[model samples]
Target: MELIFLGTGAGIPSPERNVTAVALALNEERGTFWLFDCGEATQHQIMRSPLKLSRLEYIFITHLHGDHIYGLPGLLSSRSYHGGTTPLTIFGPAGLARFIETSLQVSGSHLDYELRIEELQEGVIFEDEQFTISCARLEHRIDSYGYRIVEHDLPGRLDRDRLIADGILPGPIYQQIKLSKEPIAYEGRLLDPKRYVGPDIPGRKLAILGDTRPAPNALQLAQTVDVLVHEATFAEAEAELARRYYHTTTRQAAEIAAQAGAGELILTHFSSRYNREDLAWLIQEASRYHKPVYAAYDGYQHPIPRK
Candidate 1:
């Protein structure tokens, strides 16, 4: 899996950074991509990147803030014109449906594919064979949320030596033994699948938070995650202003990542006042507390490390 940052600025678009939009590309895992936020001009950002709209299968809105969701209607409408006929699902807070519906209806936009909008609360929102998504409330100006995307543990590789020693050759029966849950009778002996299987490979976990102050749920959502994407809307000097605006500072975001024991931290949702040149200070401040901290910019692509 890979993370592609479309826009990383907060509140408004700047020349260096646009707004808040992230794409978790799962092309190798599931042949689809999941978007975290769709800020204004998000589609335009996608055009400038290697991301494909047709591969977008899900959109998770962190809140109803205009900067976090203004481009939803346009992206959804344009998906039809592209090669996006497959079903798409969106998860967000309450009133998200009204916003999308009103925007589409007012502009006479129609989609040719199935669209599902699920209002999120503080709980497990989605789960499938591959992934599980959960949300927790955050302390923001509005009802913002942080999402935890946990990938399911994949089955371990088959032990060919064990199979060969047990008189099992590399044939159709090997595939059956690997997939079957019950014991298989091979040469008058019951071969247990568990005995020949190796350990399960742990999956990667990612936590993406919206605009918020440091809260208990933030740590809960990001506990020991592979990547923690948190908002750092202000520098260390602007702690008072950040708290007053119900946002997080660089130090506060770094503390969250350090406390949660996240593998890596990517600080995003920067204030427009700070330009690209100011990112080194933010990254340095965060790195003091957390190793491998990154201040995200538009079109930044990060490859998730496989442990």
Candidate 2:
């Protein structure tokens, strides 16, 4: 999996940055891409990146803020024209459905595919064979939430040497051993499936937070995450302003990362005032407490390696 930042600026699009939009590309794992937020002109930003809109399967919005959902109508309408017949699902807080419906109706946009929406609350947001998504509300101006994506424990890999030593050549049987429950019988004895398994491999985890101040729930949700994507709308010196606006600063974000013991901290949703050079200062301030703090910019893709 990899995270591609289509737009990392906050509130408005800048010459150097766009609004907030993040894409988690899992094409190799599931041939699908999941989006975190769709800021204004998100589709236009996606056009310049290596990501494919056709592969988008899920859109998770953290809140109903205008900067987050402004691009939904255009993206959905364009999806139909781009041959996106596959079903799509969107999960977010209440009023999300109303916003989409009103926007589509007023803009005369129609999609030729299945569109599903889920108004969510604090709990398990999503789950599958490989991952489980956890969410909790954050302290923001309005109702908002933070999301945690915890990957499930993966089964052990097949021991090819053990199979070959047992006179089992490479064929459909090996494929079955790697993927399913259909076991093969060898020399009148049924070989157990577990014998051909190697060591178990653990999966990685990621956390995505919306516009909010530092809260205990946010810290708990991001605990030990492989990658923690938090918002740094201001620097350390702007703590008063940040709290007054119900947002977080660089230092507060770093403290959250340190408190949660996250392996890596990625700070996005920057204020429009700071330039790319100022972004480095934000990272440095964050790194004082947490190592490897990444400041995101438009079109910057950070690969999440399978460990």
Candidate 3:
């Protein structure tokens, strides 16, 4: 899977960064992409990348803040125009449904595809055979959520060479032996699937958090994640200001990653005041506690590997 950061600024757009939006491309895993947030002009950013809006299957809004969700109506309408006929589901706080529906209604917009908006709570929001998504409350100015996306363990490759060596030819019998629950007869010999199948391969985990201060839920959701995307809206010198504004400082975000034992950390949602050159100190401060910490930029792609 790959993570594409569409916008990485906080509150407002800047020359270096836009706002909060991330695309988790699951084309290989599920043949689709899942968006984390849709800030203003997010569709414009997607246009500049290799991502396709038609592959979007889910949109998980962190909160109802303007910086986090202003592009929902426009993106939704544009998706229909772009020939996206599959049903799309959105998960967010209680007010998200009203905001999107009201915006679409006021603009007299009509979509050709079905749109499903769900008000989220602190629990598992979605699950399929491939992945499971769960949410937890975060400490922010308004009600916010952090999402944990866990991929299911995949079965290992079948030993075709071993089966062939054991007087078994490649045919429908191989399919039956692999899928059957009980012992299968192959040329008057019973074969067990356990002997031919390799061990189960572990999947990857990712944690994406919304605008928030330091909280235990953040660490819990990010535990042992392959990548932890957290908001670091202020530098260490602005700790007081960050606390007053209900945002996290560079040091606090790093602390969360270190405590959670995350494999890697990508910091985003930077304040507009800090330019690209000014972001080095933030990364330095965060890296003091955790190694391999990175500051995200718009259009940056981070590919995650299975653990």
Stretches of candidate 1 exceeding 4 Å from the true structure: 180-182
Model 1: per-residue Cα lDDT over 183-274, one tens digit each? 98887889888877776779999999999999999999999999999999999889999999999999999999999999889999999889
Rank by lDDT, highest first: 3, 1, 2
Per-residue alpha-carbon lDDT of model 3 for 207-230, expressed as tens digits? 999999999999999999989999
Model 2 agreement with the true structure over 119-207: per-residue lDDT tens digits: 89889978989889978999998888899998776667998888899888888877667665446676687867778875557888999
Query: Order of candidates by TM-score, top first?
Result: 1, 3, 2
TM-score of each: 0.96, 0.94, 0.96
Candidate 2 local lDDT, residue 235? 93
Alpha-carbon RMSD to native, per candidate: 1.3, 1.9, 1.6
Model 1 lDDT on a 0 to 1 scale = 0.92
TM-score of 2: 0.94
User: Candidate 2 vs candidate 3: which has greater TM-score?
Assistant: 3
Listed per model in order, the count of residue pairs whose N, CA or C atoms clash below 3 Å is: 0, 0, 0
Winner on TM-score (1 vs 3): 1
Model 1 TM-score is 0.96
